[model samples]
Target: MAREVDPKKTRKALRRLKRARKKIEDSEKSDTLSDWEDEFLGSVEDRLETFGSAFNDPEKGHLDEALSGLQTAKLREIERKAAGKARKPMSRGKGFKSSFKRKGSGPRVRDINEDIEEETPEADEIPEAAAEPSRPSGPPKLRVVKGDKGDT
Candidate 1:
């Protein structure tokens, strides 16, 4: 025989559960809890533990550990989002095609050829008399004389 559940008792229990959940949600938003709230949460945790979920224990510092882990994960996600935003989308299609001629091409080639012609003397042209050596003109040339150490 199935024992029939009392609808009134079930409704009252459901309302109480809803109220507790609301309180917890409000506490989470405020990020502060009074002693009574702590005691209430501890009792809820004990009830949850009986069901084998083993929710975070404030006395064991598990709350801080969980909070730190959550904060780190949130920071990492924020960093990832920021990095994603920072990247620019790659340009598609042909992109910027410069109309200017490259080096050694077009007018530059003509300028280079003219420069080369100006620098080089024609083979048939008679060269001017070679200039006097600049160094020997400044000072007497030094000659190295090797002598036996014993003679020195």
Candidate 2:
């Protein structure tokens, strides 16, 4: 016969499992510091600790303010770095292959504009169904409709 677990032990195990799952969910939602940020924060902590030991009780409040200011500056620098990266141009051609020498029957890889032209039908090759498809003759117009109290 298989050994049976005690009810108390089973309940405790369930509670621990629930707590572990909650902890994992919370960690996933939280933003973790990068290696550089962690190093900076560690240095800040050391600075704070040094200040704690070097200064007397009278200057503790000033130390706290200094720590807060350093933390704010660190956060702002990280934000500025992210914003600068976002503003950088995306036309660097990263991951784009410049030459093609394949062993198969496929056209060599082309750039964005060339790929579009290759995929679309030529102006003369379009069939009647596509050559004169039904479409509005001119640009679409937007009109205001009257609502309650003649308000648009």
Top TM-score prediction, candidate number: 2
Candidate 1: where are CA atoms >4 Å away?
28-152
Q: What is the C-alpha RMSD, rounded to one decimal, of candidate 1? A: 19.8
True-vs-predicted CA distance for residue 22, candidate 1, Å: 0.3
Q: List TM-score per model, in order.
A: 0.20, 0.23
Tell me the whole-model lDDT of each prediction, alpha carbons only: 0.42, 0.47
Where's the lowest-lDDT run of ten residues in candidate 2? 52-61
Which stretches of candidate 2 lie above 4 Å from their native place? Answer: 1-26, 29-31, 53-64, 68-70, 75-152
Please provide, for model 2 over 1-152, each residue's C-alpha lDDT reduced to its tens digit, 9 standing for 90 to 100.
32233445334433433343344345543444467765664554454444422223333433323334345445445444433333344467635465645678978676787556446777788877767667887889999987679535
Question: What is the lDDT for 120 in model 2?
Answer: 72
TM-score of model number 2: 0.23
